[model samples]
Target: MVRSILSSSTENVLEKALGASALRHKIISNNIANVNTPEFKRSSVLFEERLAEALNETKATPARTNPRHLAGHNGGGDFNPVIVTETTTSIRADGNNVDIDAEMASLAKNNIYYNAVAKELSRYFSNLKAAINEGRR
Candidate 1:
């Protein structure tokens, strides 16, 4: 189906990663913003590990030619990023767990990841458009 083609596995993966990166950006910013707040704990996103698990599962999973076929643990599309807040430990006397320097570094890294994923998706669409244009020629 056209919908299935448009939402291919690769595109789904990239989209999920992009979404995670965006969430990571917000989470890192929040951590930075709450660095001075007493008893405030830092939060982080958990996506990559779940993504990896799904990817690895896909390798051993048998292809299902029928829609009714039993599925395996390769449900990559179902894994969503989780926001986990640290409940213990602190870097200062205020019981605040946020580390300014670490949060800054995470912000930069997530920015780069988001940009790269966005660019890749843009490129994918561009190539698809080119193919469609060429098909008309």
Candidate 2:
């Protein structure tokens, strides 16, 4: 029962998003750290579109009667987003394109978004506990 609750859909989605964002954060930090390096193209994590598509995939038809049987279009499992490409958006004239201002902005936005998701997850767990306790009373 505990395992089932821990593996709930909400938890899975939140965990996947958090993992992806954390990896993106690491990549962004690396880019900032290497801003002064010559010939270094800025890398970025591209997972939004893929994540959205996976969220939309649902199996409306099932071949087997089993609950786990193939259903709604497969979400294609966990997101394995990779660094799609490097950008040459030059913010400087030295042939280097690492824009500190843009990177900071992105990092700040990502932090805020991640925090919001975490808060939501906390609230969800709290509500679940409340529901469980209410049933006992």
Candidate 3:
């Protein structure tokens, strides 16, 4: 029962989202820190698209010919965020692509997303705790 709760898709997705957002926050902070460095390119984290793809892929039923076949793992199991560097254009004369305004906006957005995910996770745990305690009362 505990394993099932930990492996639930909702919990897994929320955990992944929280992790991705935290990583994104660090990447955005790094980009801002290197904004003045010469030839520095802004780095961004890519996870939502890949997460969506994983989720969609898991929705499909896989053919199993043998009982020993492994179950498909999706969503949080193998989800990894890709860090892509901006190389196409430079917004500054120093060849740095980091835009302070954009980075600030991204930081704000990421923070909001992180907080939302955390709140959801907290609620999930709270519900679980309540369920566990209900038998005592």
Judging by TM-score against the true structure, name the best candidate.
1
Off by over 4 Å in 3: 1-5, 62-76
Ranking by TM-score: 1, 3, 2
* Stretch of 10 with least lDDT, candidate 1: 71-80
lDDT score at residue 65, model 2, on the 0-100 scale = 75
Candidate 1 displacement at residue 48 in angstroms? 1.1
Superior by lDDT: candidate 2 or candidate 3: 3
User: What do the candidate models score in CA lDDT, each in turn?
Assistant: 0.87, 0.75, 0.87
Q: For candidate 2, lDDT tens digit of each residue in 38-128? A: 7667888877777776666634334567887655556636566678546646666666778888889989988987788788888888988
Candidate 2 residue 134 Cα shift, in angstroms, is 1.4
Q: What lDDT tens digits, residue by residue, belong to model 1 across residues 1-111?
A: 898776778788888999999899889988999889999999999999989877777778888899999976655556679999889778898899888998998899898
By TM-score, the better pick of 2 and 3 is 3
* RMSD of candidates 1 onward, in order: 2.2, 3.2, 3.0
Pairwise lDDT winner, candidates 1 and 2: 1
lDDT of 3 by residue, 85-128 (tens): 88998988989999999999999999999999999999998997
TM-score of each: 0.89, 0.78, 0.83
- Residue 12 CA displacement from its true place in model 3, Å: 1.6
